[model samples]
Target: MSGQLEVLNKKLKQAIDTRKVLETARKQQVDTLTNFAAKLSLSCKGMDIELDNRLAKFRSALSKGVDFENLAPLIAEILSLLKNQEAQQLSHQRELHTSVLTAGKLLQKTKGLPDDTRRMLRHLLDHQLNEIQSTNDFIPILNKLVSIYNQALNVKLSVKNTEDSITQPRLAKELLTLANDLVFEDEAADNVKAIKNKISETDSVEDLLTSAIEIIRIVATNISDERQSAQSFLVSLNQTLEDLHHSIVATSKHSESMSTEFETLNKRIESKIVNLTKQTQDATSISSLKALVDNELKSLSHDLIAKERLEQEDRQALIKNFHDINTRVGSLESKLSKYKKRLHEQRFKSLLDGLTKLPNRAAFDERFNHEFHLFSVQESDFTLVVIDVDHFKSINDQYGHSAGDKTLQVIAKALQMSIRKSDFIARYGGEEFVLLMPGMSVEHATAPLEKLRQAIKSIPFKFKNKSVQITVSVGATQFKKGDTPLIAFDRADDALYKAKKSGRDKLCINS
Candidate 1:
């Protein structure tokens, strides 16, 4: 009996020792994880102040099991921030490269010029282009280029005779053409054409130099407008991406915290089991053993009930977390949906003219192609009306670009009011608009356009408090079987030319 007792005690002691070792290992593991989290928190402080705060909170509450889930969320947030930073860095690099290339190309283009002019352009490029940090900075450099180019215009080219005296006009024309290629703004285009006209009409060096300088200024303005548009879109996209990343970090932290609490509770229950087992070894008699067992069982029952209550609380907490996650997900989805819609709107806007707020040439091409495809498949006919505002240049020259813009807007509104719901309108280019009338022939299309032309002539467009009237010439063409959009467009254009030749404000339709 004594030997049996000794053996039982020995085995029980082994069990106790085993449990103690396990508990020691568990503590070490917890300590190691806590230390790692603390180090991570400290290391991340310099990266982002807000993220560092979150990580610090996570580290502070780790011992209490309150911040258990925050580790992963913090990591995710750090990664997201890094990714965004990387993207921004990459964009900056690209812009830098572009600046270098632009300057290099400009330098090469002006290499044939006199040493003083070439040196001045190079100095502008090195000083202004190299220092460009933002779109705003970019505009000043372009302005500097405008000044340099204007000065370059006055510098005489090497001329040998009377024939070579024409070099000034020819060079001015070449420079204007190059400027046109660099910029494509509406006002810029008009100025370019006007300069080209002036270059053709005047042979004097002073007149050519004046027109050339104006072209450079117009080009600079156009470049600034383009850069601003690009920068705005980039800013909007980056902000949206940042918002999404923040939401992801928040949700991950909440989930991690819940898991930590549950783990802590389980560890406590394991410790209680070890303590109960050790107490069983103190039983000396059968009755005492039975009593000890009963007490242990009662204690266990109480613990089990407590555990059940804890489990219930945990379940409720889990459900709440799930609900929170669901709500957050809903919010994110809604935000994503709105972002998608805005993105689509931005894409649509890009296909539109900035000045007149109408669909531009790109939009017209898409619609024309779609309509042409349908014409091939469904064998349906559609008419194209190519309308041009008559004497439009005179309006811009007489009342300035603002008045010209207002006149075009009035003309566009009149065209919109005159068309049916099924018909579509697009501003093809400056002073030109295209109308697509589905299920309408050339004869049928003429009536609506004629009325639209008269309607445009009647618009009392007040520019600088002056009541101004405008007129438009219309040319209509019915899409033929096996015809391309360009072919149809050319026929309509030819008809428009005929209308302009015959008289202003008349509608001409191709047979």
Candidate 2:
């Protein structure tokens, strides 16, 4: 009986040792699981903070306006968070599996122990496995929330960008059209109407964008809430679905309203554009017809004037020829008179220009010499004028020589119109022209030259279906009693140089 008591005691001691080992293993497993849960919770909290920060930044961007380009980075961060969560959960499961396997091995080693103790150890291991599986299930739902949130944010950003892009150009076009219409319209009511239409169109787009932003904000908040409640993923997902359904309904209503507003605004703009287009077409037609009629009238008037000028020129030529005949007849009666008569006629013809039939440089030189001789004899004064066209070469090069020639003729005609009948004009060469006035001072010559300058400047010469404008520089010098023709010419040339240097298209007088 004493021997039987000793064996029972040994069995009791072994049982106590097994319980101690199991207890120690259980505590270690609990500690490991607790540490893992703590770490996972910390990671989750960190993820939450990061998500919050990202959302805040996104909100800030949305408040100002969403940037589509930034959406990719947001998505990348969310994906990284999901991957990290998944990896952590997987690691936790692996650790738990390893712990369970180690506990199973410890149980197998104590197979000789009573069944109740073995069952208790198995129950604890099963509970831990169930907890680990629950946490694992939670992780995928969290990742899905993250993905949904990212997708929603991306969609919002895309819509915002698209809306802005669409609206901006329309606003700009409306503003420009309104400004143009306002400038063109004579009536105050018309200007007000255009301005109001532009404002309405601009406002409609802005209001649409504002509504879209509000909707996006609502959706983002809902998604954010769903992300935070990872354990209740299904419930959160259901709530999100409800929110989405409500959003869709609201969006449909908003779209209908927006469509109505757009239709109204579009109709108004289209009507205005049509009306303006018709008005522009009518104005253009009237302008073209008026231009044609005016051109015809101008042609008729020019023909009449040219005919009268030709007749007058012919009479003058006839008179000149008749006078020459009378002089020749008188000279034929005497030997010395014939030579003198031929010389005078030759000199007179040499003094005249071939083109424009105006006085040439020879005439100006002869007149200047005679005048200076007279001034020296009588102390009288006379002015010499010189004119040069500006950028004549460029015009010739750009528009061809024919245009240049037409430009020259137009300027010559303009000069004739501007100058006094007594003023003698000449085409000096290529683009240089000259004028001379007898019995006039430099100050007196300025008026006619300036008139010619301004007239030429204002008159638009039509060439190759384009209106071309040109300017000229003029210089004048008053002849002194003692001045020779060369001296007067040099002084005029110097004044012309000064005129060109000061800036072309101005009159300069020799001091």
Candidate 3:
């Protein structure tokens, strides 16, 4: 029983020893795998950052978010495939090490073989050599291991040759070339076919390094090129914007200058109009005075002739006296007519507008009173329209006051054109105008007023070198029974005010 216990203790000791060896090997393998996985993880993470940066830059070119749903899965699949390949390589490396140990033991067993037996041993060794050479481990390490095995075999075979020594190095060189070609070909065969071909065909590790360096260089070059292109585009855009700004400024200046010219022209036209109206009034008054003077002269001549007949004895002396009185009366009559004509001419001239050849406010007032009384007495219906320019001050400020004046004149002309033969239109103030329509009610007046409004809106006024648009606010009212001219005018004025208040370039009618 003591001997049985001793055997059991020995078996337990052997089992403990075996477990220790297995634990050590497992620990080594675990450590290697951990280190390898850590390195690969770090490398893959770096690649991911680089790829993300590149993709971020690419995505920024689009206006919307990138659609990476399909692409994300593809990238994940690639990472999994790489992990599997790494695990297989590790397994193969362990297997290769075990095989090398086994081969070493076999060589040791054949150490004392005879020549014929040695040849057979050499064949077996060659087969093992082929197996080692075909491994997936690092080519240089695999080649070195195979060379060591060959050297050991050669020693046993008593074979010595300088030529054989060169063979392994040549094979190593070929294998290295093949490895490089395989990696490069795989990398180069991407979607960008031309770039792939260029990468594949390149020779030398330095060339590969240069190519890799060039990738970085190309990225830098692309960044620089993009910067330059962006700069150029910005410059061009700035130039275009600057040119547009200049054009707008020039156009604004031109409009202002034109407006000023038009205002001056309008003033001249108004002055001319005022003068012509005055002249016409003066001529009419002069004609009336001349008729009165002619009648007086005829009466005086007849009275003188009758007086001459009354004194027959002193007829010759009477006739001479009468003729003298008649001459003096005729001369006085002629002088009076001339003086009246001059006065009428002066009055007419005073009532005229120098710029527009139209009646001034004073002339309009005089005619309005006269016509108002006539219409009032006759019990005739008439409409009065007050037209005011809209945004006259703004037009002057933007285009210049000269343009404002031109706008007024253009509107005045349009009013004149729109009126009937019986209708009277006149400039009531600077930017205010008046139109009198006979036998028209406020409702009936709207058609003509709107027509006038549309006409003015349609007519383009050329002030200086610019064409300007203008509109008028009109207030119209019909004369009522027992209404004074002033009352009628006041109603029209209120309506005009309402039109301006509601909005400029619209019509308002006083009921």
Candidate 4:
């Protein structure tokens, strides 16, 4: 029994050792699976849920005392998942590398950007694209790229716009050609020329640092050297523009003053003519002369011969006075004719607008007064049309004043073509035009004016390589008896205001 007990204790000890070995092996397998799963969790940061679930199932099997037969397959499946994850990671890495390279190329292509801005773009391209490890992280970088691109494009467009406005293309091209030749000839340093040549070969911003710094320094030195000259030119330009504006305003005022003075002088001459004609008619009246002659005979001698002689002398004296008065009136009429001729030929020319070659406000005033007088005398029908260019200020603002001038010219031409020879057109002021249609009532004038409105709208105005449409608001009114020309004009102007307020490009008649 002692021997049997000792044999059992030995067997028990051996069995315990074997069990310890098996338990150690089982722990190692669990640890291996756990370590693999942890590695997969780290690698599959954004992996599919199916893969995660499979990994969870393998872990659950391991925790439930999985046999080697089952454990081996689970491990094999885990190994397969790991391989696929690695391949996916490799593909993502390659894609990221390719994207970074693409960004580098884009950075290289960008030119004329300031150093700080270019550096900011490069920093984003280099760091942002590289740090992205998954699809979810790519969006911000793409959006950042779009913003950077827009900023760069805006800067380029602004610079181009300013350059185009300030510099004439043909002159700028010539100047640039001359500058290039002078730069090459005047450059004394071989190192600078070599650096410039090197920079000229490359389009990349990264490769241009040294050349750009040197160019900036040279530009700074040149600017410092020419600062006084540049300031003088700028001052001269500003002074010239101011002088031009002042001159225009002063000339307009002077023209208006001259027109008013001429009108006053004409009225004075007409009044003098009327007074002289009345005096002549009163002196030559038959009843007044007979009464005067009868009184003179009563006071004269009773003898027939003396009375006849006195009567004959009085008749000759009266004839002489009448002849003298006629001669003076003829001279005055001749002088008035010459004055009218001079006014039409010379003064009216000044009253014409230089831009559109249309009659200006001064001329318009004279014509308006003449028409008013004619209407008063003949009682003929007449209409005044006041047309205003719509949003003219915006056209000038968007496309320089030159373009605005062109638009005015085109509109003026169109109006001239649309109107009859008897009708008169004038540039009343800045963007306002007046038309005088005589012998035509408001109803008769509307059709032609509407046609003119349509013609103006149809003109496809092109300025600086851009297409624009033009429209006008028209006002029409008939001349009424006992109403001043100015009052009639105001009514037409009011109609024009209504037309403009009511979406423009239509005719508003206030008759």
Candidate 5:
């Protein structure tokens, strides 16, 4: 009985050792989870406030050696928070992609953006946006935007005004009006009209400028077409004239040659007649006379045959000449008609203003150059004048542009009626007019310009059912020896500046 009790005690000791081992392993597993949760909580800090709070709570509970069963819900809560943040981030990145792409396109066209900077931007847009998935992909674009902003500020401070430097809002509006006046052909015309249609008072400057660039390209193409047509017409006309000249010389030579041929033929016929008469006189019998007459008739026929061939050749040559003349005349008539039509088109499209029906800047340039040439050669009296409507912007602002346009139209008519027939007037640009007064010195032109100013001031005008009085400032200058058109124009412009400065409704002259 004592031996059985000893064996039982050994078994009990073995079971106690096994329980202690399992308890130690369980404590180690809980310690490992708590240590891992501490690290995860640190990473989650500042990710989101709610995520940080939930992670902090989960980490605190984990430190208490919570079992996996009790910790599963907190782990699930952290996952949900992380997923919501990821979705919000994705939403933000999508919107950013659109804005960045659009901005890049516009910055590429900015006039003053440096080439190196532009190249970098282009590179970013081409390589980055194609498969962009996150905000990190736009890092290069973010860097470029800062650079572009700085460069734009530099350019704005230094950029001087030019034809393409249309910065003012009104300048764009004015340019649209002038752009519409240009006419092109076929697809080119439609392209220009399409671009013009896109223009509006409310469009951004970059959009409007982009449209302007496209319109300029279309206009340039039309000009090229016109040049090619004119060149072809000139070449054909020259060839036709040269051929007609050669034909005329050939006809003159042929007439003299024909006259000489006629004389030779007449002499040959007379000689034949003399020979026949002598032969007939020498006949001794009736039969011999008949044989001699037949022989003489055969010889005369041979001589007449050669003459007939020469006459036939002359008739064929004359027929060809007439045919050539008729064909050339028809060709010339057709070309002249086409040339006339082109010239009319050129005059209307290139030289006349669409709105006021007056001569435009190009016409002014042509006339000014021609008149200056005459002035230099003849040393005659020639004057140039510049006129500006007083308070024109005020009129437009208060009464609207339509009323302002009417005022300009009436003002243009009044100025036209006041000028002499020999004098020329043109719309220099917006709210400005230029005059070329031949046969008038600065002294003579001053009085007339003042009178014209007074006439413009007295013109009765109405806008928006209210009466408005219009006035003008005049500046005049006369051509002198060794003066170019540009010099004369500058003088008139300077005088105009003085007139406006002295006060409205004034006339100033530069000799």
Candidate 6:
């Protein structure tokens, strides 16, 4: 019996150890799986709706404590998405392979590329084909390369032409000019001005450092003051809302008081009338009855007179309160109107390109979303046209940023005039602009876009007494059924690439 007990104890210890080992392994796996899921989501969340939903569930389960039985199907789903993602990557890789090879070959043939430009190109091309992660990764690089190539071409052409380029002031002067325009608070403004003056006068490092420290401190204070000003606006608005609430509460309380008083008055009048009726009926003689009736009538008249006075007082109070409330409501409405106007102005500024005075990429996104949503419910389609200024960097290189800015503004105005009232145009970024044509197919859009192209080509651009011609390349695609925003954008972008490839200043419609 003792021997049997010892053997059972040993077996129990082994079982406990095995259970602990499993628990540790399970915890590690849960941690790892949760982390892996988040990593995957970073890359693939927007790729598919179903995959996103599945990832959410899997992550939720991991948080609760991972269950293999519940996770099995989810794991399968994630695996399926991974496979799909891999396949898409392979397709993108093939495209990258071709584009990169072409870029590399072009770089090899092209002469007079600057050291920095050459290095940038080599850095992009030296990556292994498999290391080409996504199509997005190479786009900006290609854009930069395109700009560089155009700059080189312009340089080569201008080698023979002896047109004197305009002398541009240093960027530092521009920064100082912009700084002077800023509304700085307290001593910061004075310090900044002093620094600007000192910069012009002395070369003492110690003096500069002391001034720099003082300026930094003052700037911090100024930023704080600016934040406080913004906060005060919110606080004032909140206080007004609170006042409105208090006014409503005061009205409700006044109403409740009046209701109680009215109820009391009704009960008192009713009780007195009942008592008088009984007393009159119980009178012993006519004289006694007359006296009793007169007394009761006088008493009731006194009560009515007192009540009338109270009611009149209440009515006057209520009127005053209503007038005050009306005034407050008017104030609130006026403030709200002012606030809305300010917000509108702020939003307009936020969505506008400062240089070109055109709606920026953020504005384009807003309009694109609206038009895309309209298509689904209203069965109305819109063509998304991407307009890229051809050899835009060349203009900047030959002239200056200020000249480029002026050129863009002129082009933007010209483009705006060319579009219909129903159509929308916005600066997409840099040298790219987008046009949205409502209830129009790409086929219908082509003619107007071509005219726009021609209009841009005809613009008389003269910088530093040298005539320079400017043109734009266009890409158009219709928003149709079974198209996501990403897919539609990709199609348009793809068309733009083709137009650029086929010697630019051309319009390609692929809808």
**Which prediction has the highest lDDT against the true structure?**
5
Better of 4 and 5 by TM-score: 5
Predictions in order: lDDT? 0.73, 0.63, 0.63, 0.72, 0.80, 0.77
- Model 5, 442: alpha-carbon shift in Å? 2.5
- Tell me model 2's lDDT, rounded to 2 decimals: 0.63
What is the TM-score (0 to 1) of candidate 2?
Answer: 0.33
* Candidate 4 accuracy as lDDT: 0.72
TM-score of every model?
Answer: 0.46, 0.33, 0.36, 0.35, 0.55, 0.55
Cα error, residue 138 of model 3, in Å, equals: 99
List the candidate numbers ranked by lDDT, top first.
5, 6, 1, 4, 3, 2
Worst 10 residues of 3 by lDDT: 176-185
For model 1, how does the per-residue alpha-carbon lDDT over 331-411 read when each residue is reduced to its tens digit? 657666776786687678667665466777788899889999999898787998899999976775676555665677777
Candidate 6 residue runs with Cα over 4 Å from true position = 1-230, 252-268, 376-381
lDDT of 2 by residue, 1-511 (tens): 9999999999999999999999999878766754564454445555456655654554454445345476568657756766776787678777756755564545445424446545544555566345646455545434533443454456567778888887764654334322222211134335443443444344466654443454345446545753664335545445545654655565456556655655665565566556555555666477775765565556556555655665565566556555654554444445335445755765565665533445665666666567677778877557888889988867755765446656777788888888777677777665778787877888877787788889989987776788777999888898876677788888998988899999898999995
Specify the poorest-scoring 10-residue window by lDDT in model 2.
Answer: 176-185
Worst ten in a row by lDDT for model 5? 160-169
Question: Clash number for model 1?
Answer: 2
Model 1 spans with C-alpha error above 4 angstroms: 1-300, 327-331, 334-338, 460-469
**Which pairs clash in the backbone of model 6?**
none
